[model samples]
Target: MSSNTLSAVLEKLIHRLCLNDFPCGYGTWRKTKGSTEGAETEETDALLDLLSCPHSPWRQDGSWSPQTAALRQLAVLTPERLHTDFIYSYFTTLHILDKGVSVVDDGLLKFSKLEELVLSANKISEIPAENLPSTLKILELRDNWLSALNSLTSCPPPRLQYLGLSSNSLGSHDVVCHLTGTHWPQLVCLDLSDCEFQNQQALLDALSTLPCLRTLVLEGNPFTLAPSYPGLTVDSLPRLSYLDASRISPEERCSFSSLSKITDLIEDRASATVSVGRVRGIPDPSMSLDENAPDFPVITYGYFITYEFLSHQTVDLCCSQKVSESKCDAAHVTEDIFSDADLQSNKNLSKHRTSKLTWAECMDFSDTQTYIVSDLGGLKRFFNQGLYLTLEEEKVLSWPAASEDRKGGKEKESPIKSGSTKDKDKKKKSVPDLVQDAPIRRTLGSVHVPLQGLVKRGHKVDVLCDLGTLHTESELEATQSLEKDLGKKIKEDKKKEDKESKQRGGSGTKQKNTAAFKGRGKGNKESETDVHTDNSVSVQLEPLTVELSVELEKWQSAAEANQLTLPHKSKQPDLS
Candidate 1:
């Protein structure tokens, strides 16, 4: 529109032409030794002559077509005189094939007489409708990557009668909507073959908007794959005279009843495919698993069908849309007053945010409980501790106790079943050692499983082992607290006993009692004897606490080593 805009457009064209070979030699016309007007006149005449003749010394082999020869001539033509008002009046046709031409410059817009433009096989990603000459009647842009055709509706060629958009990516419905009857009243021939359109019916429905469309090319498309493609195309567009390369006739037209049945079958197949994709519990094909692996246990009567159910519940809570939308700043007030966070704060919550428990929290390695306490809170309470997560694989949950015993590289023989009297006594002593090591061979928590088949099979399940040998960390802490309380009580009792003795006896006897209590308290041997004699609580727990501490340290080390050997967990199957 402006002189600056015209100069910029001309500059880009000059850059493109410089990248390719000049058909008439670059040096012959680039630096013309004459007046600017004379040089302009000389180049304009040469270009028009090249287009008109279609035969030249450069293409003497007759291999180059007339359109191909004209394109090469125009590409090499110097851009120095393109801005001149009357310079474009000489050229009526321009074909620039494979020249990487993306933009049609405003300089080209001056071609008021341009009737044909062939820009096939170029890098143009969009239709340059605004810059196209109004006199353009035939425009071919084959093999271009045009994703939008809406621009043509906004600024179309006033006298455009033929359009070729073959091999482009014009698949969008919005693009079809733009090419309506009102937008291009003079449009007659439209070539959209080998495009990205897949839906046959939708394309035909959109094309019906073009009231003047006579010649419609839809070859090399999904629509043509249909059995009744010829009949359907003709019936859809009653005025389409030439369909692809074939001429349509009245005898080929089919009845409306046949068309109805064909549409119904295609629609039914499409809907069936969509429904199958929505099914759940399907394993991904990319992953490999053992063919002999046991099938998932059927959920007889449990809260969850699989581990996925528990995980999904927690995921839904943590990743809720409301939580994401709510501002993180403390000053922000959420619209939902009764949100999870609000309810938690009102009830003085101190635990983790979500109700779902972590694997570590579910385990309690204490000897106080009769069963290994996996805190499935609501599940345990509602179902009367009926659910027991059985380990499908042994190594997943436990560290082998035999591995710890084998550290010394000494192999122990199995105890004889029917031995002598001496062998019977040795087996009795070794029995306690085996019993103590049994907990290390088993897991601490439940293995979640599916309940689909189990419900129909009527199989009975119960807690296999209580795991009473392992003491929880909480139990150790409580033991330490009790020891402290016992020591304090002993000190208070000793002081009270000395005060009572002073009131009943002489000063000399009272002094002896005070000295005995303080001096005896500091001596380890005397203090131990006093605790056994005077304080029953401390004496009984001291030996047990020492034994438990040693066992806890050994178990912790074994647990860490076994964790390192465990394989990474696989992605769970979707059990929707």
Candidate 2:
């Protein structure tokens, strides 16, 4: 590329990567004000701003204009600095996604201080180890056309902690064998998903050498179809904390302990049953009240379960028209709920709308839920491809006044007034009104289940999901208090600004006033107490967990058995 093209691309990339530090366009400094004095003042301010920016390396002593100096520094795109005065030493992170880079050229070595380099979704086919900086900790080359990793294996970055090579063509066992700890001693995470490796045992054995490899992704490989699967891989690499993006749960590790040795007995096809049980250990709101407060509102609680899982079954659009319509209606309700001017006034309405949407998605009314799996192979593939299975506890809280109103309404409608005693005794009881205000719903906690390991066992599997509440009442109170304090501080600053403006008595010139306004705006932007208002509340608290139980089992289907027993057709003699 030409120098101008390279400069523009680099400037745009830098601006995108450091958006917070350089909010304005890179060429903003080139614009001059109307008057000479104003232009000088603005230029001085711009130079100061550039110097103060966290990402900019331009010094105030530079002979060229601030913008020109920055662009010149970016223009010298060599592996090593062409001149001694270049500012490449300040670069720490470089992200060039989908940039059509066909090679890991020597130009990248200019960034001596670079730590995180992401060149994902590029046209690159090879990564020369010598072109990489020694200080790199994160190197991602995902979605590239790389087939061999000899360059990386021959000379790896010593401090490399993360290496993303997913969606490549490295399927050969010889190529995978280079992923040993000897090459990348400090590699913590390695992603090789969708590489099409076939040898399960060899892949696992190679990965087992990495001492600090806590996370590994081997999905989309043919070997994932092996009956042993994740259990074998898990047992082989005992130190792995995560496999294929799913956390290695303690239960899974315990169940799959030494499972690699018994791989021969594992079945290819099996039916499995999974059940989610009731939740417990929810804190009672009434327990926090004192005995003397008898008149305190009656606090009521309702519970439900919500979960998310990858469904292998494809949805038929023609059959799901009614479901789609209902979802659309729910979407409209959500928009209406959030559009209200006063959120507190329509809190109940919003809660109902949110509940309706949740129910349409994954909310379950029953305390217990069950699922059966007949094809272990299909389930294993879903799990291997980073399928997420989560169970959550949802709690609904009803205020005392609402509960009392409901009770009073029931009592007033219960008795008959205009009838004889016999008639009144024979009268049927009145039914309660169906239209009631919605209760406040909150998600207490959720847990991720390792389904791959569970199904691999091919028998009954019981799992206890530990749900932890992210926030407490005390934490909410503290957050509210902090927000109030920030509001007060903002009000006080505004008052001070108003007083100062009043003291000027409208005597200030337009330019000075404009400058003053810009200064105030910048100050407001930088203020730590500038509270950002959002629809949701934020709070922090210690983990308070509740437990729910789940059970799972697998069995072989009759169709699979029949297929295995069917004899192959014999060719007829002398048919030709």
Best by lDDT: 2
Worst lDDT run of 10 residues, candidate 2, spans 567-576
Model 2 residue 268 lDDT? 37
How does model 2 score by TM-score?
0.40
Which lDDT tens digits does candidate 2 get at residues 1-576?
Answer: 533222344445444433222322233333345544533233444544664466766432332112333443343222133233244566666676776667676666766878988877877787889888899999989998889988777788899999999888888867977988889899999998777676677777788999999999876654554335666777789999999888998777776676666544443322222333334444444433458643323344444444433221111212212344335322121222122233223331211111121322122322332222223333444444322233333334333332344454342222334368876656534332333345555666556655544433323334545555454444455568776776787678767767776777565654566577668767766663354343224433334332333333221232322232232113211110
lDDT value for model 1: 0.45
Residue clash pairs of candidate 1:
298-451, 298-453, 298-454, 299-450, 299-451, 299-452, 365-471, 365-472, 366-472
Looking at candidate 1, the ten consecutive residues that score lowest on lDDT are 268-277
CA lDDT of each prediction against the hidden true structure: 0.45, 0.53
**In model 2, what is the error at residue 262, expressed in angstroms?**
1.8
CA shift of 556, model 2, Å = 15
Q: Which stretches of candidate 1 lie over 4 Å from their true place?
A: 1-84, 254-262, 265-576
